[model samples]
Target chain A: MDYALNDFLMFTPEVYLRLFERTHLALEPWFWAVPVAWLVMALLLWRAPPRARRLVPVAMAAGWGLTAAIFMLQFYAPINWPVGPFAWLFALEALLLVLLALRVPPVGIGPVVLICWVAVLLALSLMTALEAGTWQALALPGVTPDMTAVTTAVLLMAWPRRWRWGLLMIPLLWCGFSVLVLWALKLWWPLIVPAAGVLIILIATFWPTSESPDNA
Target chain B: MRLPIRRRHFLLGLAATGVAVRWPRTLAGQHESPITRAIPSTGERLPVIGMGTWRTFNVGNDPVLLDERARVLELFFHSGGRLVDASPMYGSAESVVGELVERLDRSDDLFAATKVWTRDERDTRAAVAESEALWGVGRFDLMQVHNLLGWEGHLETLQAMKAEGRLRYIGVTTSHGRRHEELERIMTREPLDFVQLTYNIADREAEARLLPLAREKGIAVIANRPFQGGRLFDRVRSQPLPGWAGDAGVSGWADFFLRFIVSHPAMTCAIPATTQLAHMRENMDALYGQLPDETQRQRMINDFQEI
Candidate 1:
């Protein structure tokens, strides 16, 4: 069907941004633990790559589940009918992450790269939260879909497994979807999501997989 | 030939029914009743200022937003507004309007209008049934073929439903200045009570053909996107109204833009959608006092162009 970008989005930017605040309030107090857990996991991944390999994906899986339940189902689905399928897509990504956790080999990712990834993800989350005009509406990794997808894509780039492309599919699709929605709403800051995804893909494709010690 | 007799009877019936309400004076301080136009076919008078549920009323199931929107609706009805337009394509808007109308207990005054928007020809009846269920109105005052999607099948079914007393009126709609030729064709060939298209001071393409055709065909023209999807407000945010605007019953930009459309000789109503109660009040305010005549409408066009 021939449709304009405006046709796909039925809510205004004000209503769209308010979703974050409402979601945060709906899951209050307990919501604080989500970012804390994500921070601890990132610290472990940066400092101790070997031990954190299996744990990181599992934590990310849980984040995907939470995003599906809290954000997609509870908040977004009402405003956008397609969000119901998006919630299921999130659940599928969660399942894929769990599978990755089970099968992932112990790979060594350098501390510098890991820390940079952590900082980037953290900055993106804070930027999104601040745009909503409140810290409580923080779009934390492993809690919200955009940050969680970007974090997963970047993390998978560190691993040189050929099958990692399979895990990257949903995250990439979601990033593209987010870009369209944000662009339609005239929200420029959140465009960093798909930009980061593209940058990571380029880096992962060009970087010498054989020479990198992380491949071991 | 029969139009004058029908119009006379319609006016007499309106007097007998006493359905019209006395609207307050315009912001320009003019003493005039709220502007209402009679349906060409039935001569039922509808207030010219209608509400639209496009991007504004799709608040989902949020209680806070629902209440906020209820207040907007309360102000609309209080200001003598009616003829609320919605469609199945607008997410949760139909349900939200249904809920608010039920809560406010103003269904009797509401000229409930919604659309059938499905690609499947067989789904036309089902879509209307679903809208009826969501709106809790038993039957819609007007059922339109949204964007003319599957209009051929939907219009046929809608005509049957009207005959069966399940629908009061049937029409087709298009927006953003799309498919006017097809819209004109439908108006010429079919017995439509209404035809909604994009019409505003900024977008006047409909004036060349659709509006004139509607006038000739005796079809009520519902002006959609009267504010150009709220872009007109953004454009004139820093600009001031013309000094002589009050003479045309324009107190603000909302009135300036809306009165231009609803003032057109062919227009039956203009539906301006807004989420804010203040905006709803401003939109409803356009209903009062004198509307711009052709010369003033031309001046409005010139003024907006300079902005």
Candidate 2:
């Protein structure tokens, strides 16, 4: 049986909420899935990988910790910003992913661009948060996270400059997909997982390791 | 007579049926309310209380996160729910929904509904292609003009796609307060299978024109924001949930609001956004109880508005 501790928490909160007729939106509520997946990915990565493996988990942890802290602030005190807390927190986490990806070999201009994007995102978020007298006023802003690019960039920057240039092809694939999906769906949230999964697969598939699956 | 050929073509959707309609989840133990509507363009019996993807399911670009979301969907299907509605406006909701269906290896249980929100014909076509790609389905049960954006451009493209046999249903959507008269005119003009609009306890304006017109026009209604931006929850705050609500099988504000909308003869479903999984099950569960008759409905209206 899947021990649904999150479900239990989510489900259990209702027992008391039922007493009050009000719709109790549990602010600062945890989405057990985020941590659940994070740790799972971290465990897998720690076992695999170059020296960056150590840095990856640490950056992810810091990213999550800061994101959590921001959420806590937003939950207790509302902010008046253009974006939601979720989006801002997500950008922060994406920043960590860029940092973590850097520790692994093959850090490239893509990571730099990403870090820059995060910087801009942070600046914008900071402006919004500061403007909002209460932090709760901030909203989730628009930030599309495409891991294909980062993964492709990693492959490209890995040097040994052979036909491995085909590596960047993966992100090109995701880019083509994002164009269709974003245009068709009019939203970016659905791409989150398949893209991440593809990134993980590419990371494992291309790594200069014994476990790499042969394409041929 | 022409419809038979079309129906045959659709039934030739043997591929789709094999892929789309999983055997009902509730067939064994539970008794379900038997209210089915024929797709006017082609006679298909779709259960009215369909599922919607918005806040809860849309977590774009995160695969591992999606794996966990799988259970929410498992519950939806296991509970005998079908007819999933999504749109581009909802931000990856459709894509995430599509991904989940694929992961479940159970596209057979879905009545996929999605929408386009672009103005240009190129953009509209691009959107439809993306919808198909993200969801991993070759066709859609319904594709609507999200909030009526560039609807003229998108509607023409949808009409063309329908003619080409890519989509079975063409529809439109609008949210939160609108020029109902204009919406009515659009509904009258379009050969729409469904039209999604905001209708809730607080936003009952749809009742006056849009809904009556939908009933007369034979267009399906999808109620959105059934809680009216969570205000209904606030209004019902601290007050005791009426014992009668419990009798209707509603456990929380989400269900109470959803049931109220679906209880209407015109509504196909009420799609509420929730990020958490429990909310998904709770909202879909509202389908189990007795639909409020006119008397009880009016009583619900009176009490709700008074509050």
Candidate 3:
């Protein structure tokens, strides 16, 4: 049990990064639909009615499902054994998202918070592409785990305190796991993942309920 | 470690006078008989160069990488390698090796060796069965207790398997210079056929005790991390090889580093892992040509220290 972090990581940074490019290649032509899903989610979150806004979590659930199936199970599990259990965790998160969508009331998130979340998404996508040294390897929200976790955490912050804490479990777990993996790979730029997770937890806990209708 | 004045003067004289020693060159498609060493327990001989599947062979299910790694194995066999060592701890490497070995049809030539690495004693037989299913080979030539985890129970099962004619060899392994005292105690108490630990020019701690113990106990020694997980190359990347290195058939750093390890009397073979065909070729080249004698090994140690 006294194993080093590098002992669990069998592949090199080069091989790990190439996984994104290989994933992109595997989903070619139909890959265009991924960005389209992102745009639709953004538009629905920004302008839709309160009842329609419930679709946001439903959409996020789809993102989690895709990431678990395509990225974690297909591309990563082959190289890293622990990723197999991680894929099941993601699938469980997707099921939880569906439950949240059905049971929880939709909270009205402000335009400012929505815009900041979108900015965070775009910045993460660009940073991932730069790290991979290719635009084609961009880790978009629905197609990759890191961005999907970040987006899900931010969206879950709009819920009431009890629901928020329960729903944030998987995304937080994933963010912490991602931080260790990136740190072990010696890549500094991708630490943005856990940072964003911390920011979401802070905003969800400390932001004044009187100032924002979403916290009500 | 002081050198004899005459031998020192001869080496310095070669350096000072710039005497060019002809290094043996083995080109691709040219076959030279590889050097072999006898297993201590049984006189069955294995080539000095064996293949290791650590980070290199864990390429997963990618067709392109599978084919590429298959070609690397192909080159290894073409260069006269037989023993291939793997473990269940290395993700997907066992399955990948099994698939590639079947594809190349080299199972007959392969001296397949793998390890049982789990904390549960009851799971040892199941783990070996899974490995056999993955490797597609009916029986493994060797099965080791990786890192000495659950060693007592696993070793008992392995002893039974050997007695049942289900396995040819049983041994224990540790790497990165960890747990040497425990390994030493096991070597003394257990009836092991082989004892693998880290041995290289950089990490010579094994030479002090475990290696000498292995020699005395008539146990075969497999040297893992012969290049110190590829860190030794980084140290000598910018430095030039000694002028007299070619006199011992040292053409490149791989040969220089590897020859120094396998040249030891106690070492049965050194398993070096590589992904590229060119690097595999360089590693296998160490199997051919003359190895450094006792004086030359010290000279190699001296040269390495200066770097």
Candidate 4:
């Protein structure tokens, strides 16, 4: 296992990723691109079908978490191969996307995908923290799965089931608290994004649900 | 042998000759010809601190990256920068710079220059048109036969463009150690506005023939590979800045290195690539002062080797 871990982390691709990133610092503009990409995704989500709205976040969270896990696994630990429970869940999400496209989840499977993908991301976040000795770099938005999963999950979980907005407010509060922690750490734009998401969600909630599903 | 735009690729380098009309005085000798000049091809003066669109800038239009770089170019304009050189070989540099400058609403500030790399006249026209479409410019200020690839055919087209005013000037470029002989032969025969070649304290061969020929022809020279494909940087870094380097008004090793190229009478500006704003500012600073004289240039060479 030690042999496997050493060689795996020390592989050329891992070294290349580290060097390419360090050499270019291409991520510097992520301060702007992240927000811009968000605006694009948000615009994309605003007009997409309920199923697309639901699956998009779920797919995003799953993809983001899986990519993060892959990075940490390649860097800190070794995942050796790609067959596991999360792999199975991702397969299930893929299947769900097809179903959602067929209009299967009307209230939106935003909750369903959120629950599955966020669990995976949090698990990876935990493993990455355990392996790296510190979570300093891993606490940022992309470093974890889509936090939009949490927001969409909150709305989906709270609304149709008649649960008060308070029930969903727990994760919302956690999101808020994480931003505060990040800010105190002088995390800069890393914390600013989730904080902005908080404002957008608060504003979005006051918005009426007057537009029901056209074909629902 | 085939420097086809489809396969023949090269990184674009920055040059001088703008900022005459834009900002306040300081650049008293800024060349007017955008790239470099032979003699009296003079018109509106070109800025010496122009942008080179290569590597990542070669990627065809991504509105997001374009928007960010637009601000960078806007900053470039505010600082009185003018030349922007691109090539069909540089993927989409010509196009992206065009779209970028256009969107920034400051396309007029650009002294646009590009290259023809393909082997056939038909491919040459197609590539030039693509560059025109990419940048939305009707004509290019300078169009060179890139790398001397298909030089016979492309040079004919460039000659025609000159006659029709589709191009303002013509030039040629080549790199690496092997091409020096072929590059030399082309230099002796061609009427070129600018001859772009590799020159640094490290690669001293070009100084023997190319530089002298350019001086004799009255052709302007563009020095590329000022850092030897960035290998020069790796060699001298982490060492203390030479004591006398500061006496030259150089703030960093970049100016220390590039000014050596600029100081040569046979040379024009040397273009070095940097995405970092700090590095860009340092590079632009090289053009602001008097270049090194012969004795100082020799010392610059001796110091570089010692490091």
Candidate 5:
């Protein structure tokens, strides 16, 4: 009936890292191309024509959906039941991204926001390679949960002021959840740095002055 | 050869009286007295050592891991294990146990115990049914309210189910020594047949109140987290088990740890889960041989503390 305290502490850093390694191995040649594609997409977001800029949310939706479908629902949910609901949350986040993408392409994301996204992507990739051992086993940026979280955070900040806060909910909530998990599992340094970005956004922003569509 | 000799005598008895006399002494060691304890409510005897399916048995639809766990169950039953405890919270564990028991055709001997852990009365009813289906047991031997969640609502349903003969016993559980005051309150008020709680030698908080309360209330106690989810092993991994542990017939630290639990007079069962065959064998080995007396139980506590 009751869980042993240790049950909550299962999947130490080594075990969690192995999931990424196995996922990478399973995903293969297509997986190898994901990081390159992610880099190209981030660069395009900066100076791409409005037509190309519109594709950002579409690509971000695919990232969230893939992380949910492949990483969370398929791999992680079996061992960690808490992730089962989270898989659906990620899918819903993807749906939200689709809705946003269909709307007009907003004023381009600020240079500062794009820089933070790049930092999150690089930091996560470096940490995955460092901790998991072998750069070859690194998680694809934008295709893994940490990267998806960062991408969502950036996309939220770039949205029209009305849509930004509601859209940021999932990624911010995930940041808090990941902090607890990563802290408990003692995967400290990488999580600590990337998590600071969320803190910065929290400091700079206030609660929305106008209600979102939920009120409508 | 032994069976043939017994059969010849039985046949002679049957030929004389036209009634077959069953051989009482056919398997000598098989009758070696197993350590068992009395259930407080019905005075039924149950083996003191039981199996827990916590994180250890949560493998989901993996045939290879299922086979590995099945072999562990084989060793458990082979060593006189009877009670196998599980819950819905232990992801895929109930279904895994159900599949293993059905595949091995050993459900008859298993004492199935699980819990309902939802928030509402309707959800609790649905959860129990889901567990029954997952475990493939038409009825559970014992059903407990997990972590005392929705205890009032689920306890009502469990009591009703027990009266209707759907479950053999009703109880509640908690771990990490959380909600002890609330648990004690319920224990005093409810007509529970069992109370599962964390009661390892390392975490002996239950000894102060819950164990004594169970004794006074005539409620059977199922001790969980007996090894503290391998924390005890981790503690003594480097240090040598005290030489005096041999006096209590402890071949390894697992036996030392488990025997310390089952030896407690109030402990009806101690469920320790392990995925490895050797560890399961080690756990079951504690079931046989000598258990420690009060003096020795204290000695174990002192020794563990020293380590």
Candidate 6:
């Protein structure tokens, strides 16, 4: 028999499962704290003044930084060697979030898109929690590529259109890559759930908008 | 050829009539010679058992893990192993092999087999260069097109390289016995020195056509996934070794599975991957003792099926 494309992959689905289970198992005590932080950010986005709400990205930045340093670099990178460079990219994404949060320009998306994106993130968290069989599994949500992609989608909604693509670049790319990895590992349900969210954000962002006169 | 035969017969005369001296006293201080087979293309002899580096040797840049993997290679060589098969797709296995061999300074008897994995000519050329650099070797003994990704194009380059004295042999590899028809087509036309494919007690489909074809075409066969990626062990882990296995001189299930594989007259070698030292020894031990003849092999297969 000739070799199949899957034969070229370095790892099997078992390897990925082991890595994820290890990472989640290692983050036991910190799991509850993740949801608390997210709850606070959600409240600020819903109830705070426009200027105060600008600081929501501050929480996003902090979450991403912690995900990069504590979750990815410390926990995941050692087992999966290729993830080392990706950990640094997560750090860079954290920095970018911090810059966007501080700049706080006139940035807002339609309420409908915001609600839909938030629903996607919550569904992702629920699915992960159900799979892991614990709410504590939510602690390092940003560490998971799907959660990170969700965060990027929400952040893009608040950022101006011109800046959206640049900020969306890394997480979007990660979503695509994770889809392949998940597919190889045969984690069909988890991958399909997040893939749907990613598709929605991609369609919304790239969908042609009616300009001052619909030039095209 | 005639002189080597006389020398081989002289060595065999000193041992059992059918047995060859596998490890000379100066080499490994052993009594019974491990079984050896001829590569159909070149008539060069290699041990019937070899080491495979897939997930086992891909401990990328971790010094401690690299040292541990090095120990595995050391044990392989010390146990009279010659062929170490790996591929670029195995993460950092090629580099790990290079590091261990360079450190042990045991490249002389090592039969290094690696693969070219890309499709584009420029990428394939660069990939070969990178593999050579990672292996820290001047020449590869066998270079196979990995999974036939760009087999035709890479075959041309491999042929050219072989002509230029850059490589000793060219071949192709596959796993899980996925693409038999396409591989059979290529095998019929290509002047391949080797063909690597998955074959284990559980996955004996290769015995139907591929093995016989290799025997006919004079292409050496390298049996991979000999333990069915650890599934065979899981199946037999709790079961007692068949009573007759001891009489056949197979010590453990590993040896039983491996012996069953290499016992085929057409089979060249069985390359099994393992990281643990004890497992490596178990795998190497399969090279020793009496290989079951055709009837015994059929009985062994039927017995395994009953399990």
Best by DockQ, which number?
Answer: 3
* Tens digit per residue, CA lDDT, model 3, B10-42: 335535755314312443325566899999999
Provide the DockQ value for model 5: 0.15
Task: Order the numbered candidates by lDDT, best leading.
Answer: 3, 1, 5, 6, 2, 4
Q: Rate the local accuracy (lDDT) of all candidates.
A: 0.81, 0.56, 0.82, 0.54, 0.76, 0.73
Clashes of each: 0, 32, 0, 11, 0, 1
Identify the leading candidate in terms of lDDT.
3
**Which tens-of-lDDT digit does each residue in A73-161 have in candidate 6?**
76455445566787788778889878876775324344465566567677776654555455544423555656766666665555556
Candidate 5: segments with Cα more than 4 A from true spot: A1-29, A46-48, A78-82, A99-123, A126-138, A154-166, A187-216, B1-34, B61-68, B122-124, B179-190
Interface RMSD of 1: 3.5
DockQ, each predicted model: 0.35, 0.03, 0.38, 0.02, 0.15, 0.13
Query: Which tens-of-lDDT digit does each residue in A1-216 have in candidate 1?
Result: 135686568887777777777777877878788878876765666556564657878888898998899888988888888778989999998998888777764365666876777788778887666676778667777667788778777767655557477777788778778888888888777667666766665565555542344434
The candidate, 3 or 5, that scores higher on DockQ is: 3
Model 5 interface RMSD, in angstroms? 5.0
Lowest lDDT sum, 10 consecutive residues, model 6 chain B, at: B1-10
Ranking by TM-score: 1, 3, 5, 6, 2, 4
Please identify which of the two predictions, 1 or 3, would achieve the higher DockQ against the true structure: 3
Better of 5 and 6 by lDDT: 5
Clash total of candidate 1: 0
lDDT for predicted candidate 4 compared with the true structure: 0.54
TM-score (all chains, Cα) for each model: 0.90, 0.55, 0.89, 0.54, 0.77, 0.69
lDDT of 2 by residue, B250-302 (tens): 57667677767888888877766555556665666566656778887887888
Which pairs in model 3 have colliding backbones?
none
What TM-score would chain A of each candidate receive against the reference chain A? 0.86, 0.26, 0.88, 0.37, 0.82, 0.78
Q: Which scores greater on lDDT, model 2 or model 4?
A: 2
Interface RMSD of 3: 3.5
lDDT score, candidate 1:
0.81
